[model samples]
Target: MNNTTQNKPINGNSLIEIGYPENEILGIALKINKKRTGFTKAEMLDKYAQVMSSPQDFTEDKIFKSLAEAFINGIHLPKIDEEIIPLNENPKEFKIYGIEKIEDGALNQMKIAMQLPVTVAGALMPDAHQGYGLPIGGVLATKNAIIPYGVGVDIGCRMALSIYDLPASHYFEHHDILKETLMKNTKFGAGHGFHGKYKAEHHVLDDSKFETNSFINNLKDKAWSQLGSSGGGNHFVEFGLIDFKEDDKKLNIKKGSYLALLTHSGSRGFGATIAGHYTKIAKDICKLPYNAKNLAYLDLDSEAGQEYWLAMNLAGEYASACHEIIHQKITKELGAEVLAKIENHHNFAWKEIYNNEEVIVHRKGATPASKDVMGIIPGSMTAPGFLVRGNGEENSINSASHGAGRQMSRTQAIKSLSQNKINDYLNDFGITLIGSGKDEAPMAYKDIHEVMNAQQDLVDVVATFTPKMVRMADDGSKED
Candidate 1:
């Protein structure tokens, strides 16, 4: 016996070289290796030859019976088909607003998303920027499938505005008191929450849905702790001034400038946990190509999908609760009366009617601009945010930009911008900054005016709110 042949063990490759079908190679090699563990490669080869020569003799043998029968009958093992959902050959046509201002990467992401077999329609807003799965400011409508990434990690992240009856000059008249109230009343940054006397209360924590699943049940305590707290990364609690150039019937306020409180936050740790858990389940069940894996979706009829839907809605409600509590607390502290309130969730999913058919609409970093719907679109810390009324444009899937959108990446902003420059902008705009990093500098965002101009058909600006005092997480946290 040759030494090389004696030492070399039989493997699938060797079986393939011996004219065995690719599908049967694994079974044949495994059977040979298990039944003849101590036998050398030469002995194995000899046995294989014997089996091929007189396959009937080994028909009764447990391990060799199938191998012999397969050889005698010249039959190949059945191949298991991989369950892969391919991209649509003919992708649905999607609309893009402000194409010139949008980066190519974001536009490319939108194009790729439109190619999804589940995707029915999509639209890219003026604020579109590169993000995971769907780009920020990307609105996608799908048929009976929900993509977790499309809803974003910070599920139900939204903007809340409370306009007070006091004049805009009230912010400056009591700047010190107002700034102190924001710092003391709000909690920012990750994992930072109110304790003891500061812990807030909300009715969302009492919902029976929290008891439905172990995953959600465990989040109740965390939700309670962070009930009225604001999370980091573009989340802020600010004192601002809202100017209504003309009388607005919706708010019923006279034409004038009024003091207001604006907040940006979400369900905090609760929503994040739900998103992470369900996104993993979606990826496991929904097998897709490498490029589209992140966009994996869960069938709405499946158990997992139902659970996610419930959990997502609960998180959205919890987020709204956080804002409500924050407003209640601050209003009580300041002894100010709220004249009007406007709020909307950007990162969420809604079952809406499009083309006379029901579809799940996922707005990732985008706002629902359905007809007469009220939403907020914030600018940079120094720029002015807007209160807008939706026009319900069918081409945009009734959506608009969520914010001015990042003109530069956080890393790029940190590398290119300086604290001195940020200070100059704030000073020039008569804005006071409490705690924030250079990454959130005003220069890092697109011009809000230009963004609004580009989406004239999508929404109508009702009023403008200019930040007077801004407070963000001191810790450099990533945007939700």
Candidate 2:
């Protein structure tokens, strides 16, 4: 029998007949030991034979209930020398795409996350790589719970693309102006914030959610200060050419090529603080099994859970606002009007219904792909990114990989990859770099084409983007 399967309540009395709100100890014990919380009367009697025969309480009901609570909470169960059994139940096996390409470390992390009692279902994308709790391309659904580490450190990290009315050739003709716009409008790298003339303003700063929770309120000043800046690591902003050999409603563009700007970033320091604060809270309260410690969860009905939901959504808005500011400022400066845009977040959670049951779906480094929903999956700076629409496959948790998920860690790239080789590779791909580090070299990632191919059923490529000019963090700096 699947341990995660919902059990029927005893005569509609949840924790009541066995001592509900009146019995605080029993409630805590039930919460700590999830398996034996609502056992049927017959099963209860059979499982606690010693407790049922105890004479101290005289009544079977009183004696068995007390012993059950004590047994679950690791306290003395009267004079019974009984050993509590562990919940050795397996969660639903995760459906993985491109399993052969995924690393063993990432697969191990996925197994641990699946062991979490809250996990309802899980999926691993082709771009899977080891991350905090869930792998970078892992998707997880939990029952009335949310995992902070599963959402990862960079909350609301996303990709946005704005297509322009100008032809692809226009970028080269006005290269200097486009370059100047990027330089003057956006700041990149770690701790890069709006200063002097580059400071940006957005309506997200006025959101009430910021003050709804102390965590968001405390991050307001910092969030406002860095409104338009892009965080470091693989985060970037670039000019590229989007190709569509056939007309599509998703893009609403003719069968031709056009100039586009793509930006990848998150909620900056604001997100990091919220993640750090709530992750600690989750870890402190939920004492999960050893392998599942990083996968600690908070019940949706809890105060912290509600607060985190608000904070996470607010961070998404902040991230979108940052993208808007970057695109608006750069486009306006370049005198280029927006034709159309595509945007989607990869690092976030949503209240989704899967298997006809409501669950909190967390996509760490994955994109939500609800049937026909549009999203962006980027590759390395030099490789191609895809404009896709979700196929809404249930097994995949309606998601796709966020990018050409890292094939190598930052430390590995920095050590083995030389600047000259990176430059040569970029030049070979006709990618012009404005600012970047060797750590983000194209070699550091898996082939974008292969990743897209692996998840073909999850998403359909509507268009492809080839980077012409890219900007990212410079060498020898801390990652975001």
Candidate 3:
């Protein structure tokens, strides 16, 4: 009588046909109108049609799925604090050294990191460059939480320098043995490991954490397999010469050139898997504002936070073991005695006192420069690395740049650099590079001298290292 055929509404049969349970439909109804209850099929259909025609409706299918998911996940009305906090109109102040040298994108990422609700303080190292979430050389102090990406994909990525009693000439005299040792003792590239009887042996495999933590326990075999290998992308195992200054007390060696084995690596696949797994969980639990998308944090008191803490610390130990095995194997293969070892983990989190309060300090690509702390900061293949002692300045958060940070991205390097030019540059430096790609060429990095000068207040250089022979991953693959 009133063109009723044209005015038919959505029926319960339609909802059933679409596979929504009654409770899901009811939840959607309540979401549309909290007072909605005790509705007949016809009444529900009328309300659905009314809401669908209103401005609130955009996609009917999405609304249905969201309502269904809410029921499945037990999500009801959001709690009072569920809303994302507004971007800090006034981010807490932080320190930045070598500001002029830092890229704008890196600066922006640091600013975003400063806006995180848990961030207590922040600092940018001289080697600052853009990376995922946190800038490469940025340091952040947070309250009772840790950002996984803040520690980086290569968890416990570090620099290890082992000074030997042998003179620098030993490397040149027995170059063949050094070459064979490097080739035999270390495996580079992603997912590559020793076969049969050649696997590295380390005590890190005996840690109880591997048995206790499921995430870490799952990675035990892989971790064991990659124990002594140098995972790629800026990671390297090199034979170098260290010239100690007379005033250097930490090394306490004669002020002359000596053969040193310098290695740059991390926790290998074990770290990468842990980072990826936990970061996703952090995102699910913490609804961060758009600005802090992948920079989410897990509360320290929460179960996940504790688990990650255990895994991360274990990974740090494993990384140290990796360096230990590499250095030990190489030194043993050459029959060289070690004089001193200087090592530090850059990609890690530490429980430290900051501003008279305990905080978790995350250094992505920055070194911990707590007063008199020794760390190794490497340069490009053709450049020099440094053995430095931390000055423990408060403003810079007792941190220094990890290395002469990349001046250009890998894509830029691969696109711009010529293989012939890279070869010529290596030849000029008299450096024999093995198994490296164009992306890690000398031109891709900043001048190490300038970077050291910029962070003079953060650390004091104790010795200088010159790379004589270096090995990295082969080309045509991404290692990190």
Candidate 4:
């Protein structure tokens, strides 16, 4: 399988985390043909079931745990080094600048990264948290090839910003009725979408892409249905107040401040499933047993790769549609008009010229802070977020932080903060509060100020926003 793929399947610099031994796992897994592989899917399933039936899987878990430590960079392993979170994740050779936590899973990912290499330079932004393979707040740059998993299953998953003319106080005046209307018009959590709500027009085919397949055909339905829905986990939409009135004394626009609505989500499960399917194809084609499973990628020039690129872009469009649907819902309930909306996807790949090389730039939790790039910089529910533009700082590859980095994990947030505290914070803003489980409370993330300060070399802030009523998945619903 690897023979048919590009010759350059390995990346030395990116292989650091999966260095030495972890590639063996991929080698072994690939050697066993899916049909003849000793650990067939059936056998693997049986093993998983037995392990679940008792605790045998714990042994594999422990083995994987140890192997993960060896492979993943910025990961914490039991028998590994002391409690030191580096100011820069890859201090040597790589330019990653921050490492807030290095847990076991992250280590495992490093071990897995040995074979699949990334060209996109990374900074491991302060909000770094574990996701499929790439860390939630992690950043990466790649050349020639684009890793599907790096952008994640939720291709084009990102944050959105909508500015408003009304002040935060205006929401308070319409409180109860607005909340009722929002709930009725908008739906949150999994499987939340409006079936057949949009009109899908076929785009003229790009040069390398092929005719639409059944899978692609189904996507049309998915998009229409998933419109206006907010997927579970950390995905959310909030009404916030910008506190930037001349030296922080203003609540009005004279302070260059504005009331904003902020939200975080992705292309929903439709994108996730497509990403998963192709990621597997990339892995199988690579056949070399990469150190990081999620680092699977496709060359931009190949037929399959072109198909993925087209699909990925389409998914981004769908994600934007989802947000637009939400904005409409909010407008209907609040009876307000939107001043402007600035939306960008931090996940997904871009075609750009880096170092005079025409390359595909895959930004995984990082926004392109190119000289003209305009994007949002969101904070926690109670902190300040911003809308910034890139000054074309090459050191950070013209990229900036995604949001206020996370200081604590979801479990930690739930343990440390109380419901009353959450309630108090929301009340102080006098904004409508809605769905958000304890996992995504404001305390779960890091301070936005420090994160921005550390990244001053990357981008310039155009505006800052403070939270009014931040809504996320509620305590009673599914949390990711």
- Ranking by lDDT, best first? 1, 3, 2, 4
Kindly report which residue stretches of model 3 are placed more than 4 angstroms away from their true locations once superposed. 1-85
Quantify how close model 1 is to the true structure by its C-alpha RMSD in Å: 17.3
- Model 3 poorest ten-residue lDDT run: 50-59
Better of 1 and 4 by TM-score: 1
Tens-place lDDT digits, model 4, residues 383-453: 77887777887666677777775566554666678989887876775545577767677777777777787
Q: Against the hidden true structure, what lDDT does model 3 obtain?
A: 0.77
TM-score of each: 0.83, 0.81, 0.82, 0.72
Better of 3 and 4 by TM-score: 3
Which has the greatest lDDT?
1
lDDT of 1 by residue, 52-166 (tens): 4234435655556778776556454222464777898766788988888899888877888898988999999999988767888999999999998888778899999999989
Can you write out model 2's per-residue Cα lDDT over 235-345, one digit (the tens) per residue?
A: 889999999979986556888899999999998767765775677577656766545655778888999888988888998999999999999888887777787888999
lDDT of 1 at 91: 66
Model 3, residue 205: distance off in Å is 1.1
Model 3: what TM-score? 0.82
